[model samples]
Target: MQSHNQARANAARRRQAETGESYAAALAAIRQDRLNEADHATEAGNPPVDRGPDYFHDKPVPEVLTELVRYHSHRIAKHLYFAMDEGRWRSDFAEWQAMTLYKLTDAAAHLNLLIGTITAYLRDEGVGRYFLRRYLQVNQDHQVEAYLTPRVEEHLAGLTGQPAPEHSIIWHSVGSDIASQSGWNHPEQHEALEAALHALYGNYPDDDEAFNHLPPALRERVLALIPLMKDQEHSGAAD
Candidate 1:
């Protein structure tokens, strides 16, 4: 029989293949699911523990949520850049451009909704808006590189033939980072965000930005094989 660790590693690899998540992210999800299951089993015999909306483990709620707001805001900044870059990529690749923008907008909408709710709950719109608007203000100032150096670094690494690093290396999008923190303090909102994400991208809304930023010719060749990849994913699911 396979050892438990081997089973978990295999499960994570399958998840990474199907969801296009980095290996660390897929592993994190697997571990988190196990934890959630264990917690649920434990709670089944006990009374539910309820807390106030503003409760963040006794930390200043607004302060912590504001940081969550920053995380989403940063991701939204990257989406905006990618949306424009798609158009700038080449005037002739209209299908690719349209697909990118369509997916990106769906991605942005999720993040925007998260920002709006976080601000409303904090009862101070300025708390979120100030940080969000600064990202937008990159147009008037020379803040693009300073604001998005991490994203640029991914593309740079890809150009040099490096594989995508583990999630710890790019902590910006860790589970407790931008992607899963969508209203996590609120149980209902957390479930809703999870559903919306699966619906929007058929997985996570994030693209492998580094892979997408590869030279157009090479990227196109890979994209053209996507249907075959989909078949592989389905077969893995069956197993």
Candidate 2:
């Protein structure tokens, strides 16, 4: 994995130099920093950055749901970048673009799961219908909403028994919007962003395949750690 990441980073740098694009160069730098961090942590006998609390903990459901959204949102953003890069390089534009869309759909499905879980938790907490209705309102103007698959929207509408709010942040789309914008705009910046994503995540199975393959126990553990990891990343950035 490390070698693969390094090779991708090198390629990104070369691309950036050839095209005067900054995206790949920026990504290579970030990847190097992360690799260094990982090495230092391993040497110090510290747990990996992503290692976190077990899934079946007694934490508040809202908290757990929040973390799940954060974690998957990060993953989805990485995949989105990769898909974008694939679109840039591959001759089969339609196929690559469809793959990208599939990744986005997978992201939406994961978020829908988090929303369902949160709703159930709110009900248990005795949040009244009025409050719940207000809670579900789409209050934000987020670009991430553009990526939400129609199927996921339909599924959420079925669950709510009303049309899903056309503009809600239910999936924590705010975080996704930020992730998606990290290396946007200039060509170099975009390529660098793509390089960083490829280095970090490589290619993973599509969302449905990955979700279906997970054992229940492992899945829960992953759910528990997702938010915790996000918190750690934020804290690290702050520091």
Candidate 3:
């Protein structure tokens, strides 16, 4: 029996042959139809997990790196909550357990890819060294963080002698402008950027010169977020 996706692929091939359409175009159309069906299913309150590509897979290298760092950081943050309250929850325990298991399994599948992507970016990007340092500082996974931080620090220590705070300062600075230009419309992107910035700023609590190494425009944007960072610090202290 032909599976649904197989049937769709066959139909797409037929359409491609009949209309002289590119295979890529046919596949894109099929994907769009599948997405539309998924959207309809969601609207009917029976939301389906699409489980397509990871959010960053198709993005440019810089954006991919940004999202990779943000995603893992968010995962680590959630793990902290899960760790602290593993058995205390009563309501939604089943659902939470299912989702947590799924995320853990899924993340494990992608761990190697995530590491490879970051390594590739660090090797290829023009400001790779700076970004590598920032990633090391901001990432909360202690095992990988401990391993990579010293290696990166040692490699660049001779030239710069310290971590370059400007990478994150510039990344978040540009990210804010990008988010604002979209009128802060993309809640998911905004949330991801906020998480990334929180992680970045959280690592440099007392560094008054954190943004000083950034370009003027980027520095201005980063400096503007000091109040928010301070607020986070206060909230953390209260907790």
lDDT of 1 by residue, 1-239 (tens): 56445566789889999999898788779878988986676666553243222223235434445445554555565576567777667466867668677859866664645544443333332333333344345343333223333443332233223454454254223323333444322434433343333333332223333234335754554555555556888999999
lDDT of 1: 0.49
Candidate 3 lDDT, 1-239, residue by residue in tens: 56454566677788789889886677567768888976775567632243222323344544434545455454555554464454455467877687666656655533533454454435433433444445445444443444443323332322222343443333233223332433222446536455446435432333333344455755665556766767998999999
Backbone clash pairs for candidate 2 read 21-188, 22-188, 23-188, 23-189, 23-192, 24-192, 67-227, 138-168
Candidate 3 TM-score to native:
0.31
Give the CA lDDT, 0 to 100, for residue 222 in model 3.
58
**Winner of 1 and 3 under TM-score:** 3
Residue 38 accuracy (lDDT) in model 1: 67
Residues 1-239, candidate 2: write the lDDT tens digits: 24544465666566667778575455555557767976675577643233122222335544334333445455556666677776777788778878877877776665565465454545544554444445555444232243345544443343334444556544334223323432221333333443344323432221212223345654454445555656888999999
- Stretches of candidate 1 exceeding 4 Å from the true structure: 1-61, 123-239
TM-score of each: 0.26, 0.31, 0.31
Tell me how far the alpha carbon of residue 144 in candidate 3 is from the true structure, in angstroms, after superposition.
Answer: 14
Q: After superposing candidate 2 on the true structure, give the runs of residues whose Cα lies further than 4 Å from its correct spot.
A: 1-63, 138-239
